[model samples]
Target: MTTKNVRPKFLNLFRIHLPVTGVVSFAHRVSGAVLVLSLPVVVFLFALSLHSEQGFERVSEILQCGWVRLLSLLVLWALFSHLFSGVRFLLLDLDIGMRLAAARASAWLVLALAALVLIALLMGVLL
Candidate 1:
């Protein structure tokens, strides 16, 4: 077999484990994409409500529904995760947590911060 084909197969034979920082960095991109995709729907709904007084009332009532409230909570969680991770990346740009161990720890710390912020928001403590 040619070396090119053999190299790929050999690499695949081993289970590759990514460090936490790599995982967080990849997820940050994905979450940004999620935000981009979700933005239009969210903005459309907001615009629909703001177009008139009655439309505003209608949207307000719909928001009080359990499912709508749940979906809103989830969107808030996604927003927090993306925002916090972006801050971590900005810190990395400033020569912070570039070491393997520190990068991993910061990655986990950012994840924890996101979760804590979300939970606090859900509990009405932050709002």
Candidate 2:
């Protein structure tokens, strides 16, 4: 069987717009993945810091590097986003905001709260 006109499998998927709820759901999974993948590195750093005073100083020095600082910011974002989105999903599961309009609004509110919290945490870390 030969097809003359071929449509790419993901073409329509890429072209279509995702609703707010979908966006929130996507972000939630991405943030959770980042956190899960980062656990090993985080644990290593924590253990190194606890090894001795010198180890703690080394950990602090490593964190002071520009790339490490940026990575820390990303971790903060992942943590906050995961937390906020989890709460949203829990509420949805309970049928608290099951309506289409309420679901959309809650999705946006979670995103906004996560951004604000991330900014605050970054300021604390940087300053």
Candidate 3:
């Protein structure tokens, strides 16, 4: 008699748990993608703003909308997340924080720092 296969044929992503480091690494990749994708739009907006007084005012008006401000905040958060996580990754490459505990702590620190930067930016913008 042969034993039956017990392996799952499909993955349930929602049921899978990742460590803090894993989450931070994944966020790093996602944030990088977001920043890359947003670059063209940012360049276009910049060029438009420089075209003339009308163009500058139009860009300003578009940026002043509540939804646009929220989106800008998200992009800003992505930028910080990518920057902090990148530095963490570079430190990891240098064998700093190679231990499991240190790695985990660094991962948490990266996340916390990025969030703190976002919060500070929001406060500065709103106040």
User: Against the true structure, whose TM-score is highest?
Assistant: 3
| TM-scores of all candidate predictions against the true structure | 0.78, 0.88, 0.93
lDDT of 1 by residue, 1-127 (tens): 6555545545652477777777787778777787787799789879989899988998889888888788777777778889989988899999988887888889999889888988888779336
For model 1, name the residue pairs that clash.
none
Cα deviation of 43 in candidate 1 (Å)? Answer: 1.4
Clashing pairs in 2: none
Off by over 4 Å in 1: 1-17, 125-127
Off by over 4 Å in 3: 1-6
The deviation in Å at residue 35 for candidate 1 is 1.0
Tens digits of per-residue lDDT for model 3, 56-101? 9999999999998998988999999999999999999999999999
RMSD of 3: 1.6
lDDT of 3 at 102: 99
Which 10 residues in a row give candidate 3 its minimum summed lDDT? 68-77
Better of 1 and 2 by TM-score: 2
